[model samples]
Target: MHDTTHHALQRQRRQVIWGLTLIAFGVAYLLQRDDGDAVVRLWQYWPWVLVAFGVNNMLPPTDGRRFVDGLSQVLFGAWFWITIEGWWGLNFGNSWPLLIIVGGLGMVLQPLAHRYFPRHQEERS
Candidate 1:
């Protein structure tokens, strides 16, 4: 049944993400800096966890709700990444307002997006 295939696909995607994360960790361990500062450096990558979750939500059989949720996740992850990296001097203190604006924008735009690309009934199940 379609349900079975969907579950299988989800499982496979999860396994892939897990496998890649472990591999990245293993490589980081092998290439770690002297005095074990590598682990400290790796801690900065926590935002990637959100990115992974966002990517998972973007897999397939997209629905309006999931599409919006996935977009939010991706945007939040990117925002966090930028904040953590201090890119262009963006940080929580300075950029928090952008979050509210972007979130509101997404909410306002969702209905229009859904209208333009109506969800198919088969995709819902």
Candidate 2:
């Protein structure tokens, strides 16, 4: 019974979040429709999508997989901002090493984190 209640609560939370996100997007769409230049310039903020993904992965009940995915998203978002968006005029060739570093860190830390801070096994039951 407790698990059932927990599952129901999780479902409710997800529904609420989805509904709010849709409403927010609707508002943003309406607000941007009147400004042609703003709409066009919006493409430059594409890295935000990666950031959003990263945030989603880091949301509550985080685990090893989510941690790795979140880390990748954050790293990708930063790389996109620096190289694609040219935030600091960084070159892709020079920035490739950053990707390597992030990936290596994720690989090294994930096991240790999972070992030390394992998620509760109750959800699995």
Candidate 3:
């Protein structure tokens, strides 16, 4: 079970890395995003960055490191959301298959990311 959990966690990390890479590839479109830009349109569905933030923060803290990492993730997500909405003028579209694929992937990884986080251990007396 533990091995399974660890494997799942690793898989989640890979998913996150790949998903973000796909999003990053949209940067050119993101930079020039308008109604006609497919890449930017694709990135428009990233509100789940906020959802990931919420999930990442709800983990047990082992020490200051965990807290800092959580804080950073939350901040990064918030910044990403705000910048995309405010600056990028984000909007959703009918890119059903791709949107579903990416969103579902990111969502699936959230729980596994939470699982891999350091856990608070009992104090040795």
lDDT (CA) for every model shown?
0.75, 0.70, 0.51
- The sequence of per-residue lDDT tens digits that candidate 2 reaches over residues 44-84 is 66676677667666665565666677878988887888897
Among residues 3 or more apart in sequence or in different chains, the pairs in candidate 1 whose N, CA or C atoms overlap within 3 Å are none
Per-prediction TM-score: 0.76, 0.68, 0.34
Clashing residue pairs, backbone N/CA/C < 3 A, model 3: none
For candidate 3, lDDT tens digit of each residue in 1-125?
25456446645754785677566656756666665666546666575565464444444332233444455555456555655566555333322244455455556655555455434322211
The runs of at least 3 residues in candidate 1 whose Cα sits more than 4 Å from the true structure, single-residue gaps closed, are 113-125
Candidates in descending TM-score order: 1, 2, 3
Query: lDDT: which candidate is best?
Result: 1
Off by over 4 Å in 2: 1-26, 120-125
Model 3 bad stretches (over 4 Å): 1-40, 50-54, 87-125
lDDT of 2: 0.70
Which lDDT tens digits does candidate 1 get at residues 1-125?
A: 36567667778887888888888877887788564877788878877877886778666755455557677788888898899999999988999987897699789877865765464334554
Model 3: ten consecutive residues of lowest lDDT = 116-125
